[model samples]
Target: MRTPAARTRAGSAALAATAALLLGLAAAPAAVAGADHRQDATTLDGLAHRSGRYFGSAVDNPELADTDYANLLGSEFGQTTPGNGMKWYATEPRRGVFDFTAGDEIVNYARSKGLTVRGHTLLWHSQLPDWLSSGTWSADELRSILKNHITQVVKHYRGKVFAWDVANEIMNEDGTYRDNIFYKTIGPSYIADALRWARAADPKAKLYLNDYNVEGTGAKSDAYYALIQRLKADGVPVDGFGMQAHLALQYGFPYQMRQNIQRFADLGVDVAVTELDIRMILPADATRTAQQADWYGQVTSACLAVRRCVGITLWGYSDRHSWIPAAFEGQGAALPWDEELRRKPAYDAIGAALTAAAVRRTG
Candidate 1:
């Protein structure tokens, strides 16, 4: 295996060049736009049109200048989300100071392009501003703040966003509640409260409990199952489960994961493979790359096998733009697209899975 530093340096060089090329062409005259681009012009668009679903990507504000990716994505997926922009930190950096301009720009852009919009999250532990996490606030105060934020944000986007990640990453690996400030202060009931408030703010939009590592059975998944059962029994407003299918080449594909997904659907909720990517160490040889492809195929097959799995969004369009490389040392080329914006084996694998035996409907 290549060292993480070596891989980062190599991957960084490749990604930098790719980013530069994309940025440069974005500034070029519109007439020449279609002449030199490398992305498969028809691939994503064709898949989305045929599948009746949407693909998504995260965007940095700077990348917004290069509308090529967005244009390409919109053509195919016809749906967009902040990816990270709508998170608690970006939306509300200060206690009461809400800033939706950045996120709103992305949402408005998607809408203008005739695309459906999904809000990335309403509640999450990551990317939360320091003040919210560190401030000395009473339990009641925290609950009040949380309720207000959810109500305000959901109401603001009412009728526009097709779905919202109402409560994100709330459960632990053992499926027990992750102890966050919200959970600590407001207790386990905060999840239900957030969902109820979101529904009250926008009754029409679908609300989801989003998390990573819940795609397969284990401690974390078991916890989610119990939580969902309790919430359903209590008549909480959770309508969907956002499975962040962040996979790795080495880990065995969670084969029985569909059974868990079916259980959720049985409770009358939808399941979406949200923010998916399969990461592998850099200098990927042919065999390692093929393993990555197989991992993607297995995940997509699971989603297709489970009936309630309605949406599958690659974490990003290409490895060049993937966050995993930076976030996870040595983990590069995590997505279906290669450095030059070309489709990899993983792309073909997913496409095949989607077209696989008619998806088995559950619940």
Candidate 2:
């Protein structure tokens, strides 16, 4: 597998091809274009705010520096998550060594755009610096390390971030905690400890335990439910649950998404659709595109139904800079916008959902 740097360079080339594809699709006629833009309607954040929610997208550092992308981000989204800049590896390359350059850059950009920021994560098993990943440490030693890291990073972002993915991908698919280093070394309480340390560092930022495949009813989500219930009972500072809705058409939509969200809300915490994207086996056709669009509306509808579902955030907003193609071979076209910054069917579908939701409130 290519390193992230290599993939990023390759992604630029993919963007060029995607842009060409967008130009070809752009010639498809005016009616399609009009529909794609949601009838030249209001921004996503505008539509979401009407229904007392936020609409947001994740952003990486390089893309935020692009003028066109930056402008679109400012106008379209109310919140942003740094795709990687705030992660443990990026922030601390060595034991006791700290770096905030990348994260600070993103935070400043989000503030400039009047976009509230969500910290991507406080702890995860992957993407750790070599010192931590390869070294051996006792249980108490690892626990101290984790608490110190979480406290510092959370303190740095403090009032700037609305929430933190305090613990991420902690559970495996079968409703059990993955055998990650944190779990093995610090035991299950690492989650509650992480949340507590983060809360102490920044009392205002909402703390969340985020994971993929938890958007629907399943064993994995059930595990999260039990864990959350336990944590709440013990008075953990967990403020929200995050469902990383990374869907693929080949696998079918999640089973009864609304109920899945509602259960978490009933547990007394806000829920968010974080890192959302719908990818299909490549060479997108009208059929696949329409399916993707419909899925977007459905996701928004599910989130709207639950009062505590505070928001929906796209993993990244455009096909141009998406991590899909690289991460999942032969699969792409997973976002609402095409490479030329043009809205696709999914954009209109999302627009329609948000508008419909707001209308229901006003009606």
Candidate 3:
């Protein structure tokens, strides 16, 4: 379709008002009185399941040691993605030498919780092993390396994961392809080759091209929209577009998010709100927390509005284990749960949105 830049930026104000109403209604006396009262009720995943979608969280290996955090994660969410376990650096630290220790741990944990795993990232520009990044390789050599990496990884986790993020963050903010190692060494066709290789390894697993800043209708998202169309026309196996909703309060909400999701869904592929976290300025106040909760509700509502928008996975479900503090200095407290594993305003907002969707489905 046409460029999203041409459309007017809309819907943020309306979504904010909607979230305020939901939070007011959902934050009843009983929900606020008891510390663990909400825990006994239907979870976010339980509500989402009514409308045929899954709710999930990303977990790092270290955080599994925290029993309280792990238990909440396992029970409240229906799916889990390893934040760094399935990445290239963790999976293959050396050339031709593979390790599945980290990924396997997450898969086993997810299985125990009856949560399906989402294989994150077969290919990415960052977090590559020293060997692969340090050495300069010809196009053919890098292509072979990519194929082998994708093939082996997908083969290993074939039936375990429901989907594979075959290629990630491949596009730049301006809708141009990023000058990543794969693009620089193997050219633009590397993405298609990676998808094909993964599909060959596991035909049952859904293949996706994932990236951040694509939740809105803009140049970055427009790039993916065009790229997916081209891939489909070429008979490539592309199953979904992942909008890593790593939102920030300063950036405002994604422009026309629901409409943007609909456009992608219309293109005949599923859309997912993968890696969701609404970060605010450090030392959050009531205003910032409310805004964060509003954004969370808006995202949940947008995904629920679309039939093909399959699921949402928070980057991390709690502030205790968030990557935000380290990654985005001076900015933290991005998740729905606090450091103590207590539900925050955002949690109630998301719950309200999911609850509303469930009611709509059964009503």
Candidate 4:
């Protein structure tokens, strides 16, 4: 999971210098163009924002000004979400105290721009208010409180949000359940209960179970598969699965990651490449950066090839504002857009993959 923090004064200075270099590169036409650039750019841009899209991102940092967001909205990208807006802590910081100001602003902004809004998360272990963690309430009281929170928040944004990650990162990486407050108080049944409450609040919204490390063969993925199968067998209202593709360059990307996605899609649920990003060290090496670009191309192509994979979103817009630098020590440059907001090779590679998909569709 990615965490955010203020950069150290020294780190900030280094980032500023890097940003200047990126800005200069972004302004250079030669850096922006190459063989088949125009055609690929057009196709990539079109497919990127097309309906049933291949690309998306979260709005977390203010560095992405309104104009920046406007430009992205005007492109082929048609979906937008507050990466952290719908989280439990961000929405309800105090007991029975709801704050929808930030989330409302994001939703209204995206809707006004004619973009689809994905409500990031209603339940998760991370980002929960401190109050919720303290053992103060009985099981019944906690259940009621949980229900009310879901009902109020989901009702508030009822019709606007296209989908909601109803439960997030509930299972551990070792195929067991994580011992969170919800699990301890409400029991394992809390997962289904939360989803049921959310659906009752807003029947129209698509509900999803979201998590990380479920992109490849592992205990976590296996656990998720079994859970989904059981839920479907019992007729649970789970509508989708959000595969949080937070990849690291050192891991060499997950082997047969797309096959894992296809397996989830086979369970008859829509699949989304949620929270996708690739991270690497600072003063990025050219060879490794190229490898990152190739990885992006491969990931995009895989999603395009699978019809049920409806959306792909970067955790952040650019390395400048990426959560990587602050969250993961010694790893920073991790997204398709560079620090200065210039399109990186990975950006072009993603565009090329989308362009190729669109060509195949037309051909």
lDDT string for model 2 (1-363, tens) is 001111111232233234324333323222211122222225677668888898889999899767777778766788889999999999999998889999999899878767889998889999999999998999999999998999889988888999999999999889989999999887898888999999999999999999998877778999999999999999998899999999988777875789889999999999999999999998999978877877777888899989999999999999889999999999999999988888887776676677667779999
Q: lDDT per prediction?
A: 0.70, 0.83, 0.85, 0.73
Which sections of candidate 3 miss by over 4 Å? 1-41
- lDDT for predicted candidate 4 compared with the true structure: 0.73
Q: Which ranges in model 2 have alpha carbons more than 4 Å from their true place?
A: 1-41
Candidate number with the higher TM-score (3 or 4): 3
lDDT score, candidate 1, position 240: 90
Task: Residues 231-250, candidate 3: write the lDDT tens digits.
Answer: 99999999999999888887
What tens digits encode model 1's per-residue C-alpha lDDT throughout 1-363? 111111111232233234334433222222222222123223432343344444555555555676666565554454556777788888889988898887888777766656567788998887889989888878899998898889888888888898998988888775578898888888888889998999999999998988887777778877777788889899998899888888776565666667877888887899888888888878788877766766676676666666677767777777666788778887788887777666676666555544432222211
TM-score: the better of candidates 2 and 4 = 2
Global CA lDDT of candidate 2, please? Answer: 0.83
Model 1: which residue pairs collide? 173-220, 174-219, 175-220, 175-223
The TM-score values for the models, in the order shown, are: 0.84, 0.89, 0.90, 0.85
Model 1, position 352: C-alpha lDDT score: 50
- Per-residue error for 124 in candidate 1, Å, reads 1.3
Q: For this target, which candidate reaches the highest lDDT against the unseen true structure? A: 3
Positional deviation of residue 102's Cα in model 3 after best superposition, in angstroms: 0.3
